[model samples]
Target: MAVPRVLILRAPGTNCDEETAFAFEAAGAVTERVHVNRLIENPKLAEDFQVLCLPGGFSYGDDIAAGRILASQLDRHLGDMVRQFCDQDRLVLGICNGFQVLMRLGVLTSGVRETQPATLTWNDHGRFEDRWVHLAVDKTKTPCVFLKGIDKMYLPIAHAEGKFVTADAEALKAFGDAGRLALRYTAADAGQASDEVLPFPSNPNGSEANVAGICDATGRLFGLMPHPERHIDPTHHPQWTRRAQQPQWGEGFAIFKNAVDYFGE
Candidate 1:
């Protein structure tokens, strides 16, 4: 099979590039870390990549609100490229700060521009929270290339503004009804354990809707306030007490593997 080329977006104050790229490489896909400026200067660069990943980090120091500056630049420079990506059914995965960027870019909503990208906002709690949580997968309707027919999976989350809110409540409901609610926090051992929604220590962020991640109406794009790259190995978890019991393939690693394999196809 031909290797899938993944683009890892980089910007001022953005971190976690190496880890995200490493995760993708481990998942069996070719990866590249590129600055947003490069893509802005040449939108055609993205044409060569099957996946675009906005990895976690405080871009522009998270100044004037998380992901605000980066989102504005992207809207101004690469908005057209983004639209074309969506039209092609290419994948866009935003984690943590990247999630904030996607939300601000309006890739998570459903309305006049719903089928494409929508918006995401701050968590109701109003504080930067970091921890893992379980997530329930509503796979009936989600058509995201990264999460095709997989059920659930665990991905550690670290962020203060990881909550997801939409201007239109009815649309959100319709999204769920259509099986577009990609990921939701749930009690531990709730069958959807891979979602990181176990309980207590697992549900760290306290997000509204217990939302760990979400997809747009079309599901080609995805945004989640989690750090799948953080937990690629069993050692990444704090639960040393159960190290022996931990599985060989940690939860976070699986998500990347899934993405790589999906794009590789």
Candidate 2:
């Protein structure tokens, strides 16, 4: 198989593209940082890559909402192209603000309804929160390619509207039942993860059902609020020096590695 090429999509105010590109390249994949204008001008540019990633940042100055403007641009100008890209044997990932974009674009929850069934809203505390969080994955529920070998991750999250909420209880249950609820925030010392929502720092944003990330029915598309790209190296951890053992890589590195490995299979 050929080397997997990743497209790191960026828009105005998108600050995390470089870090995201570096993570992908380090994971043995080729990467290119493409601006939204360039893609809108020529949607065919998407065909050159096997992976599409929307990295973090305060896109459009977070006006009207974090990713609303960019999402509208894609919906109005490049909707069909994006749909085709997802329909093919490829993968899509959205991190931080990128996840907000995917949520607004309705790509992460595709096929659920004509309108988005879930959304990332304001933090329950009504303030921006920036902190390290422990995330647990639901391996049995989702076939998400990026999370193939990841059981848990310690990642940093910086956002004000990173809370995940479904339209209703029925929708939440439906997504959980179908395995679309792929990741959740959990206590650092928690032995086995549960659906019960954890308290303030543990759950961070107070997201419903403790959701920190989610995937689509196909599991090829994923969106998460935490910045995995920020933690690809062991030193990225806040307390690497105090650890009893330092691993070769950070917990988040597995995500990029898994994405690259998917092409090999």
Candidate 3:
């Protein structure tokens, strides 16, 4: 068995690097926080790690749009390296802003030329959304490595442009047929959750199919709007004090463990 090494890639506005790194460390994997510029200076540096994580933040101050500037940098400079990383069966995890970057990197959605098949756009709310959300992962539909053994998760999401959309019927069918939709927003209780559609607060940015996260065609590349790193401890639960028996760890911690275990397997 091998210990997984995670590269928590960061940029000027990346605020969640420490927490994301800590989560991986807590999950028994070695981790590093590298700046995007440093990686751009040497794109081959990515080959040193087993996992690439684009942690959450207001990258480049979310100027122009969230994750756009960073995405452009990767697309123009290290796209091949990243594609090779995923193609090699290595893992890529994108939280919030990281998810935005993955969308533009074509890690989650691919196509010819500028004719992209899917994208994350402005939230239908027309403002920033910062709150916890209940997420449901259907293993039958998604082969996501980070979501193994996860049925329901309570994580926080903070982003304004996290809505996912695709106009092409073929593209939508492809995503469905391939089981690319890895996660979705659900009710506080999983049993009563709606399928494919939910209103604001429940659906957050109004992502079609209630999608809160998606995996690439291979399922090795996974990105989601929610912040799993924020909920590593039981205290993170909103109703922890009201529980009869408190769990030692938060629901989100399993995702980190799953990432590390992927390499262990």
lDDT of 1 at 160: 70
Which runs of model 2 end up more than 4 angstroms from their true locations? none
Which parts of model 3 are misplaced by more than 4 Å? 111-114, 192-195
Query: Arrange candidates by TM-score, highest first: which order?
Result: 2, 3, 1
Q: Rate the local accuracy (lDDT) of all candidates.
A: 0.73, 0.90, 0.86
Candidates in order, TM-scores: namely 0.86, 0.97, 0.95
TM-score of candidate 3 on Cα atoms, chains taken together: 0.95
Candidates sorted by lDDT, best first:
2, 3, 1
- Choose the strongest candidate by lDDT: 2
Q: What lDDT tens digits, residue by residue, belong to model 3 across residues 1-265?
A: 6898999998999999999999999999999899888888988888889999999998999998889999998889888878887789799999999999998877788632257888899999889999998888867878888999888888998999999888676676677667787788987766322355787788888888788888977778899999999999999888889999988789899999998998878
Per-residue lDDT tens digits for candidate 1, residues 1-265, read 6677989999998899999999999888889999998998898998898888999999999998889999999999999877776668577888889988887887665443434433455545566666666666766666655566567666667677765554465655565665556777777667452323234455555444456677766777888777878888878777846755877866777777767676546
Q: lDDT at 144 for candidate 2?
A: 82
User: Of the candidates numbered 1 and 2, which has the greater lDDT value?
Assistant: 2
Please name the candidate that would achieve the greatest TM-score relative to the true structure: 2
TM-score result, candidate 2? 0.97
lDDT of 2 by residue, 8-72 (tens): 99889999999999999999999999998999899999888999999999999999998999999
